[model samples]
Target: MNESESHGHIPAPLGSVEPHAPLLSVPSDGQLLYKISSVENLLRSIVGNYLHFNRVDSYADFPGADPHDGRQLPKDQQGNSLARFEKSPDFSAANYYDQSRARTYACCFSLENSDFIWKNYANGSEKGKVGVVFEFGRLRTMLNQTLQPGNAALKYNGNQCDQIFSVNYGIVEYVDWDTHQANVDHLQNPIRYTYLKDKERFSEEKELRISLSAMGIGQFALKDGSMMQFPSSLQLAFDFKAAIADGAIQQILYASDSDSDFLQAELHKLRIVSSKG
Candidate 1:
């Protein structure tokens, strides 16, 4: 067939097809907003279609690990990575996201019954609020991340007893702070430190450290040397305060004594607990 006849149905290319590519390119400045909108629409549609979240009941196991290159850490004689710290399997997505970079990462499982929803609001001025719907993918990605040990974990001495110490530990969870009241009740008992098996667990000599993290916002290493991540549960005393701060979150304050600091007092308390531990 003649080129014109065979390709007749094909419209003539417009000045090198690449020239039209710009139309498909998303503007960097607007990309975030677009993503937010898309996520919101997807969430509404999913929620509207599904009467309940029963679809998310299944757990997706982690896929096989990729082969480690020469850059991978060396294993000890026992085949353990000396640098690796042992962790629990009900692995939290918050922990993983806390350690991982802000960039994209792999999910531990597919979100079958779960649906993710994100809400973005323009706060006064240039700042804005982002509300996120928790889902399996987000949860798993977060679990794979880690918290900066020095910041999130606090060790301090208590005023009541010289030997009394306090520790504040934080974990990630899909549930919000309000939902954690029940969980905290369960954790009131002494936590045995297997790592310090020789040390006895102390009950009276302590206060728990306060933990703070935004629900929708992912973790970030702050400029003042603090790391931020989602909290398993937030303290009740700071409920209103936390809601306000998280709503206006742009940058996380890492190490300031200002009332704006996320968990300064909590950290101090945690240290006290740790010393005892």
Candidate 2:
């Protein structure tokens, strides 16, 4: 057995940033109840609508997983040990998320406040703060197209009735199994991050408008000969939600240093605002 298998856990090697795990959940308010049928309708209403991803405040993204430790989990048919998130392949994938690529995409999510994601990604360690789950309709569209994939192509009706889908979350790590350290050393630091005169200063905003360029080529190579890719960046808007107790949200916006320079640091502090602001 491998050393990790012998010990029954994987340790986060030193110098690696925190692990990136998104929250998952379902609702429990007594005011509303969902039948399998009704949930389908509600989802259908927005089948073609767009959901947004936001830049996460990684340090603030806790009340979450233990970065240094690992858990004992089940294995897949191929002998790949399954993390809790990958156990329910269909159900979990539909509501998944990850923020590790924020260095380039300048976007990530948390379950700190999102109860819905917390319940679904319900391993004791997986806590999500991003209250809402943006369910992707599985309707792949090309750029500037008003069209959605035909219904036959979506995760709707028939056998796919209860199966919603999302690739927003990350579970598989980009590390070495033996060392459990980042497989690629340089990629750990976002290229744009170097431009900051003050790594701590962020910005202020309610809704965010991310352009296509803010996200770099969006793909990087790992030491293991595999490529790491972020979810394609979409033109999304973060309409201010009512403020919660977290002080003004000082987030990092990872766009190109400017519209003109995708190579420099566009990473900075962004103070998120509420409608009340």
Q: Please list the C-alpha lDDT of all candidates, in the order they appear.
A: 0.20, 0.23
Error of 1 at 202 (Å): 33
Say which candidate scores most in TM-score. Answer: 2
Relative to the unseen true structure, what is the Cα RMSD of model 2? Answer: 19.6
**Residues 1-277, model 2: lDDT tens digits:** 1122212222212111111212212222111111111222212222323333323222233353222212111111112222123334332211111222242222233323323333432132211111222221111121112211222111211222211112222211222223332212222222212111111222111111111111221233343445433343332322222111221222212211112121111111123232321
In model 1, how large is the Cα lDDT of residue 265? 41
User: After superposing candidate 2, which stretches have Cα over 4 Å from the reference?
Assistant: 1-50, 56-62, 65-171, 174-178, 183-277
C-alpha-based local distance difference test score of model 1: 0.20
TM-score of each: 0.14, 0.21
Instruction: Count clashing residue pairs per candidate.
Output: 29, 29
Cα lDDT tens digits, model 1, 1-277, are 0122222232211111111122121122111111112222222333332111100111122132122110111211112212122343232322332222111111111111112211111112122222222322222222222222222222122111111112112111121222222222221111111001111221111111111212112223333444433222211111222222333111121111123222334434333111221
Cα lDDT, model 1, residue 160: 16
